[model samples]
Target chain A: MIETRGLTKTYRGGRPAVDGLDLAVPRGSVFGFLGPNGSGKTTTIRMLMGLIEPTAGTARVLGQPMPGAVRQVLPRVGALIEGPALYGFLSGRDNLRRFDAADPAADPRTRSERVGRALDRVGLAAAAGKKARAYSLGMKQRLGLAAALLQPRELLVLDEPTNGLDPQGMREIRALVRELAADGTTVFLSSHLLDEIEQVCTHAAVMARGRLVTQGPVAGLTAAVLGPGGHGRLAVTTPDPADAVRVLKEHGLTGLRADGDRVTGELPEAPPDGPAPPDPAELNAALVRAGVRVRAFGTQRPSLEDAFVRLTGEGFDVAG
Target chain B: MLRADLLRSEIATTFRRWRTLVLLAVLAGVPVLVGVAVRIQTGRHAGGGGGPAFLAGIAGNGLFLVFTALAVTLPVFLPMAVGVVAGDALAGEAHTGTLRYLLVAPAGRTRLLCAKLVTVVAFCLAGTLVVALSALATGALLFPLGKVTLLSGTSISFGEGLLRALAIAGVVALSLLGVAALGLFVSTLTDSGVAAMATTVGLVLTAQILDGIPQLQAIQPYLFPHYWLSFADLLRDPVYLDGILRNLGLQALYAAVFGSAAWARFTTRDITA
Candidate 1:
């Protein structure tokens, strides 16, 4: 539901914060925008939300040009940019009511009912009467989520939605996102947590240093990390690591390393001129034939974490 | 319909703050203090003509207390109160990060700005009424009520004097719109609410000081506070409209100029906060 073309924002006397970004978020997909801190994810989101105009380029949300069409488009889009910003003096319920009042399209007659539902959805209904200043960081984060869910939206753009939450709170937010997505609402979730993306996202985009490294379905990203053979490293635990290594090398497993009782090697790609790489079961039979006491044999599939690190050339906070 | 709701929300939020209440309390206190002080001074001396312009008349007619209180507070306390509210309107929202949510609510930038200005203007009226009403009540309790004397030395009924008092309170409130608009303009220039408030109040004080200087008389007519005290001319026999109209016109000019400036800056500027 969101698209950008050559979206670039260069602050005065500084490098472009978001340089030549072209993002396409589909209508019914949970799109994960993964990047490290200061990687322009928030900048891109801000531009998309029309909070800040792009120095050069254009952004469209729900098929209408941004900033220019903000009034027409934004009412249908819910956003929690950066974090939950609230009036500390106002109660959580009042905060929701105020934000609800801002939307011209929101029905005033049902505002209280909708605000209550949003608060309950975020598990903040009990604390709705309390001033927001007294809320914990996790509660504030949830209240921010509550504001975004105040109405049934066509698109929900959340930046770091799970930040400052306990493990339980994080799980709850993830579940909420899943529930929202299941209802056919497109969710644009941005985070540095690789695990969050892996757990919840259907489609994913990897960004590094203000540029898109790669993007596609989560399965495609993980599968693409492996070569054309779609094979990963072959790991074997044996009494005679030397014998197992010899057997694996004979089977054409490259980058063999033997340490203690374990021998790990890269399973080579299918050879065009020769033959296919031996399967893990075939390699195990070969190790057994070599008289190596095999304790364990498995192929380690690459994870999204490994894919993100490789794609971005930077480590991500893999912990949810 | 939505604009009305937004405006109601803005007005409710602005008046509900303890800071706003305290500012009103302080403004309301000024009239009581002045009325009590005048009562004491006249009681001790047994006559008038010792205090400020309107204070000396409070002993004969309690209604003069409203006039005295507005005169006393108009130059500083009233505008300072307006400055605080107006200056914090947008910047406070930005500092609290609520501005983004409000905007994203699709509260159109122009619509939100209009709501904020309306709320600030409401404060101007409310603040002035608080001082006037407080002074009227305190005046009734402290001094004798009788036929009212105009500044031109003509006698008018007490009801007419009361009507004139309400008119003066209104004029005093209108006198503050220039400062209100200026404060709102300053608010759009910063994210720090405190900084915006301080700058607005400082600008008002500086303009007052400049208006006071004889050397600056050439440009004094252009200053926002130049015609502030023209409300006193309302007490004249025919109720002089020259200075009152000029003050209102000057305030309208400032409101138009700075209000548009605020709109320009707010609509075009990036809301990073």
Candidate 2:
């Protein structure tokens, strides 16, 4: 489990890279840290890993306050931040050997065996003898993952693990993450890809401009965005668009945009002034009273993209 | 676990690098070149009046070539090689982005820095030993071996002279601890290995230059390399220890000051790379 209390990091004379934000990751969940680029996902991961001390606030990773208890805790956590940080001159096997030796608790006697097992786990056994500089980007990324798997870690923190990989490579990494989760390891995965996070994460948190916009289980996020008070858009597919628009306008629906036979507007049920606005049934009855032939009239189910857009007021860049 | 187990890995990785092998080869070549050059010159002029001050007495005893080779390479070659290795210790990792992995290994920055220091000192000792051994071999092959006359006009047995040569090599290596520590401290300040290496070597040259200037005599003793050649005192009868002791004490001072400085910087550093 990972817990953070107002964990913040501010560069000298610059804005906070990671603002005062709290994050909680339950054990054995594939926790997705979602954000757009420059949303401080990497900074938070780095602070949790104790690679950079928080400028303000604090964090506890796996039941221990980071940096202070790093030695006692880091061995149980595997991480690959940014990308594969490797020695270009050394062979992949030797690089793993060097990393394995870094853990004081590691058995030096079985170091080579552990290295071999890790390399095999990441499917880099065939390229283990090649210098890391000669490896393809995907190979290097796998090698980084291999270094993380050198021991039995209770948690795995991967920062954009599939950043430069081909589609196949990304799928492979995603599968590996799911496999690790199946083994009961807590995986705190940070990514800008909504679909990747949605596909792999059971629970998710969205960060925007160094702040936590929202956090919850994947289904809960959808429900939160779709509930009566949530920002749900209404779309009406009807042949009698003029009558439907007149009926919707009478109900005081604002920001109506229509093209051809389709009329779209925000759900207008929640009102400030008086009695609750008519329910879908009442609205349909009212439209029927107006002699409007209704084909389909319902609130649009919000996608993660829609919820993210509603939360951050900017569209998510799914292109990357 | 208290001791840095990473030292083994560091040594293995460092010595296996092509850069380290080239450094050792160049160091070993210095003695052979000095030995062969001295042999040819001394062969022609049996009663030579000129050459290096150390080679002046080599014809009387070939073992003196060890001392002569140490002197010839100590100024630039040996220290330059030490500078490259020491400077590359941390900066190279940062350049290649491996420092992040090492620190996150929870190796603890102080412990990792200590491991690097141990590796560099290990190299210094190995480098000094290689130069001494190569010069001794080359000298033994080129000249006659016999009882060696001391600088203080006292003669010692050949075995005792060889012992002295070993002692001298150790002293020379110890003298370089200051350079190694300084280079490591500089390494912590930068991420570029080449820049750190060039700066470390530049520091050595700067100190030597400062030591040589008459105007800078007031600050010469404060410089790390100022008392480097003081190992020559070990060849004197009565075993003069004043200059040798001063040189070691100075090296210890530099190592302590710069070693802790490097530790302080590296431990608190935000490893953004």
TM-score of each: 0.97, 0.89
Tell me the spans in candidate 2 whose CA falls farther than 4 Å from its real position. Answer: A222-301, A315-320, B1-4
lDDT of 2 by residue, B9-31 (tens): 88998999998999999999988
Clash pairs of candidate 2? none
Clash totals, every prediction: 0, 0
Global local distance difference test of model 2: 0.88
- Provide the TM-score, chain A, model 2: 0.81
Please give the lDDT score at residue B51 for candidate 1.
Answer: 56
- Kindly list the per-residue Cα lDDT of model 1 for residues B109-206, writing each as its tens digit: 99999999999999999999999999999999999897899999999999999999999999999999999999999999999999999999999999
How far off is model 2, as Cα RMSD? 3.9
- lDDT winner: 1
